[model samples]
Target: MRIGIAGWFGSDNLGDEILLHTLVSCVRSVDESASFVVFSPNPDRVAALHRVDAERMPTLRARGAVGRQGTAQRAIRDCDILFLGPGTVFQERSPNLPWPGTLPLFARIVGMARLARTPVAPVGVGVREGGTPAGRRLLRVIGAASVAIGVRDQRSGSYFGARAQVIGDVAYALPIPDTQPAAAVEEAAGSARPTFALSMRPLAPDTEAGLLLSIGGCLDRLQADGWTGDFLPMAFGQDAQGEDDRDIYRRAFGNVLGLAGNPLNDREGTTLAGALDGWLTALAGYRLVIGTRLHAAVMAVALGVPTVAIAYERKVHDAFVDLGLGRFVVGPDVDAETLHRTATAAAGSPAEFREAAGRVARQGRIAREFVTATLKGLG
Candidate 1:
């Protein structure tokens, strides 16, 4: 069987890359002999990293649409189905980045699938309110073309009508690694100072600094109580889009936190496998997670570390609530007092967080079944 998978790939976002990894892994388990062709912005990187044939995805602008049609059609025509998303590819500028899903590639997915007469399967995709009429229309138009649709959270399901199933985040389907994480804030056993991991993005410009300061102040107070904090970088080259998570950390909390290095940006460049190992290890070492990145918070809970989330986006807020951690997510405004309060509660409730992780695993099992069954049905 041949499948064509597409999303915001090779964009240096590890969270998005994890989705690609888990997506391909899930599809392989469903059909071991299945071959894949991916369309990405960085075709070579995606091809090498995922070990699949990849074509540079076409630009969304009208000027170059025709020149790129052949590549899109070739990839689509060869596949039985075109898989789109497991990312926040359908959100509006309200949460920032005004494009209609991955630089308005939603239109491209529909156009190519239609031209090739291939079924489009949009699995574990996220959706949010669109500020503009055109943005709202693009979502409806693309969603109408999908053969089977799966959204990542409840709020997104509301946008796609009854056919959309809340299949959970595809990243949750990733297998738990057995490797011991790298030495982080203190990976040693029985450490006196407990440490927390933090991740942030260049969220809404108006409120980003305030949110950072609030969280930073909370961390300072916690450190005074013999607690420690570490900055974990989830994306490496997103600096072009001003979305690099590390840049904000350096600018906002550099005084309080230390740069823990990402594998991609390390002085000695590392392979994707090595980077993921170090990333997971650093996460596993933390006593708690206090961050805005949904995946980081999700992973912390998955690793049995209690996490307090700052819900900068609706998707993050909704996902945590669905996992029985609603009380653990703070506001976009994120006052220090509220963050400290939630962090305290989360740190004290390891068992509760473990149970939350179990709930995620349960959802992940269903999502995997959904992927396998969907692929089998297509075949």
Candidate 2:
């Protein structure tokens, strides 16, 4: 079986790359005869970063911004099945460069599949409010896909009718490294001072300069509450590509906190793998997580740490809601007191929070089944 995956496959970001890794692995596990074709913007970059050989595997150039129209059409014509939105395909964007706006390409591919009578399925994608008429229409077109499936919470589910299936985030099924993470966790947990895991992406449309000030005030409030704030960089591809998370954070918090002994300095330029290790390590030690990165908060939950999700978009809220962690998410514009209050609430019942995380982890089992069954059904 030949399956074509259309999403953020070859990005340097660990979180986005892991979606492809997990999905491809899951497909192979279910059917050894299955093969995959990944359409990546930077196939060479993906090859170097993830050590994935693009030529050996079924690959075609279908990068959104770089214009891979011919290759994408050809691949769609050849593949037996098409998968869209495994990663944050619905949310990934840059100022003046909204590559994801090429979402219509997926719809067009699905349309081509329909013309050819090939099956299509969308897995683990999110839905959010759109800003423009074209964006909304494009969303409806994607949502109305005949064989599309999604994993957003019930709130996001409202965007699509019967066609969209509501499951859990596929990130939950992300393969744990064979090497045990317990030692790293234990070491960080043994830290003498109160530590925090602060994962922020580059300054995006949702995150402004004021975010740092708000966070700085939050740090002072935490200190008053008997905690020390240590910023952890969950710098994935955005930061790896030289996007500044702390500079944005500094714009908000630098004046308030004085920038003395900031921990982010140690983690500024690390690769995604290194950052992942650091995230796990800090989770073992931090009193709580206060950050904007959705996947970072998910990592904290996976590690059984108390995490306060700061929702810059609806997907973040949906993630927290899916994990039954509605109380853990705060608005982007939340005040310092609100941040402290929510963090305190999340940390109040650590055991219960851990229990909820375990429950969230169990959702991964369902996700695996969902993909396996969907692929088998298509085949």
Error of 1 at 89 (Å): 1.0
lDDT of 1: 0.78
What is the C-alpha lDDT profile of model 1 across 81-153, one tens digit per residue? Answer: 8888878766656443554446366677778788889999888998765546776666677778888888898
Give RMSD to native, each candidate: 2.8, 5.3
Which lDDT value does model 2 have at 315? 78
Write candidate 2's Cα lDDT for 264-323 as tens digits.
233334333334444455455555777687777886677667889888877788788767
Q: Considering every candidate listed, which one attains the maximal lDDT?
A: 1
Candidate 1, superposed: residue stretches over 4 Å from native: 60-65, 94-96, 99-104, 131-138, 179-190, 266-271
Off by over 4 Å in 2: 51-67, 91-100, 115-117, 131-145, 176-190, 204-207, 224-229, 236-285
